[model samples]
Target: MTQTLTLTWTTVCLLDRLEPDRGVAALVDGVQIALFRTADGLFAIDNRDPVSGAYVLSRGIVGSRDGVPTLASPLHKQVYDLRSGHCLDLPGVAVARHEARCRNGLVEVRLRQEG
Candidate 1:
């Protein structure tokens, strides 16, 4: 069975705090998350590098595979699925995906919590 967790979205920082080609790490209820805003003022990806177990995915290169947004790892070239948190290049590698929404000029990441 699938369990659904409700994660509260909190504004950890401002949008201007994020720079191009880099990401910011934030903690929501003990969960480590990375947020990245693309250079074009669109798109954000969590910075967790599942392959290397490092929070360096934010520092990875941002590119698209046939228009699909993807984040490359800084340590390794492993790419992950930003929306579903799946590893395209590697099988069985998945990252924690959060429900993110932008509202009132603030970006909020919905975290999942256990009841």
Candidate 2:
């Protein structure tokens, strides 16, 4: 049987705090989430680096990979799709992607309930 996932949305900050083409790390309900603003839209992902295992993805560079918005790790240079959290440099490596949106100018993130 497949288990259903439950999410709890929490406000991170004001949407105006996010700068275009940049990433910001926010501790949301004890989880480190990396928020990004690009020309396409806003995205959120796990702040931990799969390779380095550090909370540094928030400082990663925002760019594009084949027209897809991508975030490159500043610590190890691993490219990850901001929307899908796919690691481009290495296979079988990926991070968690979260649902984020602007609700009344406030940044809200849907965090999955931990087991």
Predicted model with the maximum TM-score: 2
| lDDT at residue 6 of model 2 (Cα atoms) | 57
Per residue, candidate 2 scores C-alpha lDDT tens digits across 14-113 of 9899999989999987889999878888899999999999999999999998898999999989999888888999999998888888889998998754
Query: What's model 1's overall lDDT?
Result: 0.68
Tens-digit per-residue lDDT, 28-114, candidate 1: 666777676664343434556777777777577777676667777889788876767788899998777676656666777777543
**TM-scores vs. true structure, each candidate:** 0.80, 0.92
State, as a TM-score between 0 and 1, how close model 2 is to the true structure: 0.92
Candidate 2 minimal-lDDT segment of 10 residues: 1-10
For model 2, how many clashes? 0
lDDT of residue 18 for candidate 1: 66
Instruction: Please report, in order, the local distance difference test score of every candidate based on alpha carbons.
Output: 0.68, 0.89
RMSD of each candidate? Answer: 2.6, 1.6
**Residue 107, model 2, lDDT:** 89
Instruction: Report the backbone clash tally of model 1.
Output: 1
